[model samples]
Target: MTCPKPRLQALLSAWNAPQRSNAGFSRVPSTLRKLHGTAKCAEEAIDTSTRRHKVIFSGIQPTGIPHLGNYFGALANWVKLQRNAAPEDELLFSVVGWHALTLPQDPKALQQARMDMMALLLAVGIDPKRSIVFHQDHIQNHTELAWILSCITPTGKLRRMTTWKTRLAVSRNANDESEVDDSLLNTGLFTYPVLQAADILAYKATHVPVGDDQQQHLELTRDIAEGFNRAYKTPSRLFPLPEYMTTPSKRILSLKDPSAKMSKSAVDPNSRIVLTDTPAQIKSKIRGATTDSIQGITYDPVARPGTSNLLSILAACTDDDVLEVAKRYHNRNHGDLKADVTEVVEETFRKPRAEFERLRGETEYLTQIAEEGAAKARSRSDATLREVRHRVGLA
Candidate 1:
C-alpha cells in the first residue's frame, strides 16, 4: 500500500517549521510558518532553511526486533526528522546496546540483536549517509560522559525515576512480588536515566524526538544538564536542554491485551505486529484479535478498548483520523473492519519486510555502516566529553 503522502508532507512541514521558544533558543521565523501552511510551498521552504539548525540526538535500545509500536511511535519519527533536517543539522541515531545490558541478557544474543536492529533502522528509511546511525558502545565517550554526569547526578534523583520502578513492578513474579525490596534492584537499572542524560548531552542535541512515554526521561536529561552547569560555573551552558517532539501517531496497543502498549516482551507473540511478520501472520493475528461484541465500529477507548484498538491501528496505517475512520465504518460490522484493517496492515508491511530481508543478507555492508557511523559519532561526542571532563576538573 502507498503511504499517505499528504499526511507525510504535513508531518514533514511541521517538523521543519521553526519552533517557537521563549527560552533563549533560536526560533522559527514567521515566514517559515506561513510557507509550511501550504503543501505546495513547504518543499521550497525546507530546501531554503534546511541548513540553519544544529544537532539532534535520539537513541533506541536493541532489546528485540522492533514492532509496530516501535515504528509508528519512534523509528518513523526518526525518518521524518532526518528528511526535514538541514544540511548543517547533525542527526545522530544510536542503537544503545549499553542500555540494553541494564537487564539480564545473553551476550551472543544481544550482539545479534544489535546488528538486526541496525539493519531494521536502515530498512525503514533512516539513511546512514544522511543521519549518523551507530552503536552507542562503540563510542567510548558515551561511557566517559555518563561517568562524569553520574558524579553530579544525585542518587536520590535516580531513585525517583519511574521506568525502573515500573519495570520492577512488572517483572515481579506473583510469589516474589511481596518479597521484593529496593535493595534487590540493580545499580545499572537505577542509573539508566543518568546514562540516557549523557547520551543526549554528549551530542549537545538541541532537539530529541521521543514518544509521550519518554517525556519524563527527557526532563531528567534537562535537569542533569542544568545541575552540572550550575555546579561547574561554566562560561556558557554546557548543554542545551532538548525539546520534546512527540510522534504524530497515537500509541499502538496490543492485539491480545488492548489495555497495554504493544511490547516485544509480551507473553503472547501474537500480541504484536513485528516488522518481519509475514503477510499471512499479519492477517492471522488481526483475524484473531480481541474485539468486544459491539455490533458497530466506534472509537471508544474506555468503554470498548478492543474495537478502539482496531480503529487506532487502522487510522495509523491509513493516516486517517481515528474518529473519521470510525464514522466511515459506523454502519459496518466488526468483521468487515477487522478484515479491512488486516489487509491494510499486511500491505503496509509487505515492502518493509522485503527491504529488511535484503538488508539482512548484506551483513558486511551493515557492519561497515555501523562502524563508520560510530567513528563519526565518536569524533563529535569526544569533543563534548573533553569539555565536560575539563569543567569537572578531571583533566
Candidate 2:
C-alpha cells in the first residue's frame, strides 16, 4: 500500500518552492519560529527524524458557549500543545460544525455559535498564526472523505458505538438507551464516529490527544484506516493509523450533579461554568453548588461528589493536587472550600472572559482569521483527498 507523500512533506516542499502568484496563497513557515519566537520554542519532545512530523489534530463542537469542562477538557490542553509543538509539527484545532449537526441545532444560533467559538478560542490563547483554526464544514473534503471511508465501515461496527445510545437517551431525558426508541435515532447520530474519523484521517494526523471517553472513537478510526488499506490493496498504507496522546483524565463533573460530566446540553444553566460567566455568576454558582452537610471537608468522590467536585476545581485552577487541596480544607467547612474555589474560578476566567468580550466586537479580524485558516486547511486536506480519490478509482 504505497501512500502518496506525507502531508508534512508536501507542506515543507511547498514552503521551500518558489512563491505562488495565486491570490491569498503564501508559503507557510517551515519552522516553529514562525509560530512562536525562537526563544520560546521548547526543545522538541520527540526525535524529529524518527517521527518525521507530528500532525496534531483535535476539534470541539460549536454547539454553544464553552464551559469550565470545555476549557479544561479540550481548550486548555490545546493551548499547551500549541505552546510546545515543534516547528515541523502542524496543529489543527477545528470548530467542528459537522459534528454539532448530530443533534438538532437552531441554524441562526449555530452560525453565531461558530463565530463565538472562534473568538473564545483566540481569547483563550489559541494563536491562529501558529495553528490552523477554522470551521470544519468550510472544507468540503471532510464529509467527502467520510463518505469514501464509510464504504469500508460496517453497519454493525457503527451500531456497536455507545455514544449514539447515550445521545438518544439524552434527547428524551431518559436514564438509558433502554428507555428511548431506536426508531427515533438518525443516521448522522449513529455514524458520528465515521465523521470524527474523517476529521482526523483527512489530515493524515499522527497524534491526537483525547480523554478516556473519546478513546473508543479513535480506535474505530484506526480500524477504518486499516480496513481501507486492506480493501484498496495499496502497497503502502494510504492512511497513517493515528495514535493517541493521552492527556490527564481531568473530567470536570457537572456542578449540579457530580455524578455526571459537565456538558453544554445539560438542562440546568448552573450545571456548568461557561467561559462568559461573570465573576459574580461564578461566585453565585459555587455558593449554591451542592455539597454534603457534613461538618468537615474530605476528598471522597463517591461519598461526597459535590464537595470533591469543588476540590477538584480548586486543584485544577491552582495546579495543585486535589488530595492536597482537600487536606488543607480538612480543618475548614464546606463554605470555606466553596469560597476559595469561587475565588480561584473567578480569577482563572477573568482575563479570558475580558479578552473574549473585546474580541467579540472585532468582526473584521475574526472573518480574516477564519478565511486564512480555511485556506491553509483546504490546501493540505485537498491534496490528501485528491490522492485518496485517485487510489479509490474516483479520479
Candidate 3:
C-alpha cells in the first residue's frame, strides 16, 4: 500500500514524539488542518501509523430485518473486509441494542430482533471463528467507557450536530427552527456520539467503516480521543484516533421516492426491499418502481432519479461501475432495465436469504456465537478500560 505524503508523515512523526506532551489545536499539522472535518483526514491519520495493529470496529442497530440498503451499504462491505483483512487483524461487528434504545421499543420484539440480527450476520458469511460478532449490551464496558469520554466531549459540539437536529425537525414536522428545541430530543440521541466514541475507544480500534452520513460522528470520535489524551497527559496516548473506511456500496435510494434513502421507516413497505423478500416480491416491487416517461435509458440522476437508482443497484449487485452498466442499457427501455435489476437482485440474495431462514431456527447456535463473541469482546475492552481508569485517576 502507498504511504502518506512526506509532509504528513513528518507532522505525524512529531505528533507522536515521546518528549512532546502538549496536545492542542494549534499543534495540529497543516496537513490535518487541510483535511479537517472530513473522512480523508482520519484515513490519512491511520496511513501514518507505523504500528501493525489493525483493529476494525463497526455497529448496526437491531431494528428488525435489514433492508436492501443495510445489506449493500454495510453487510456486504463487512464480508469483504473479513475476507481481505490480514491474519493478525481483528474485526468486531456489533448488534447495537443500546443504540436501538434511542427510540421506544417493545421488549419482546427487541429480544427477537437481536437474535434475528445475529443469525442474519452469520448467515451473510461473518464467520464466528474469523470475526467477533456480539450484541453491544452484552459487553458492559461500552457504556462504562462512554461515560468517561463524555466528560471531555464539549456540549457545544454535540449541539452543532446536524443529525439530531434534522431528525428532530422531521419528527416534529417543525416549519421553523424554533419549534425543534432540545426538549423534543432525548439525551440518548444528543449524547449518542460519545457512546459511539467509547465503542471505538474501548477497542482502541484503528479503523472504522461508516456511511458518508456518519462521517461527522467519526470526526467527533477523533476529537474526543484527542481531548482525553490531552487532559490526562499520560506517558503516551492511551487511545489511537480511529480512522474511517468508506463503504464499498453507494447510498441506495428508496424505490418509491428516489430523493430519500432506502429505510425501514418509510411508510410504504414497497419503498425498501428486505433480505427475506422472495423472488416474486422483488420482481413486483421493481415493476412497480417509479420512473420517468423518458424513451431511452441513460444515467442521468437529476433528470431520472428512479431509473438511475435501478441502474445503481444493478451495478452494486454485479460488482461493476455504474457508468459501465449504464452504457449497456443506453438503447433499452425502462421495462428492460427493471427486468434486469429484478433478475440480479434475486440471484444475489438467493443463497443468503435461504441461509438466513435456516439459521433463524437454530436459536442455540446463535446464542452460543453471541456468548462466545461477547466474552472475547469483554476480555479486550476490560483491559483497555482498566488502564484508562487508572490514567484518569478513577481506578
Winning candidate number (TM-score): 3
What's the number of clashes in each of the models? 2, 6, 0
lDDT order of candidates, top first = 3, 2, 1
- Residue range 1-395, candidate 1, lDDT tens digits: 54545534432343345542323223334433442365543332222223357678889999888888888888877876787666878899999999998878899999888988889899889999899999998988888888888988888878777777667656552234445577878888889898898899898887777887888788788778768867885676677656566677889999998998898878799999999898788889999998998688889999999899989888777666789879988999888888777766776677778898898889899999999998999899889888887888887
lDDT of 2: 0.80
Q: TM per model? A: 0.86, 0.86, 0.88
lDDT of 3 by residue, 201-227 (tens): 899988788898898898899888878
Off by over 4 Å in 3: 1-34, 37-49, 168-179
Alpha-carbon RMSD, candidate 3: 10.5
- Per-residue error for 142 in candidate 1, Å, reads 0.7
Which residue pairs overlap in candidate 2's backbone? 1-234, 1-235, 1-236, 2-235, 2-236, 32-87
The local distance difference test score of each candidate is 0.79, 0.80, 0.83
**CA lDDT, candidate 1, residue 348:** 63
- lDDT (Cα, 0-100) at 346 in candidate 3: 75
Tell how far residue 112 is off in model 1, in angstroms: 0.8
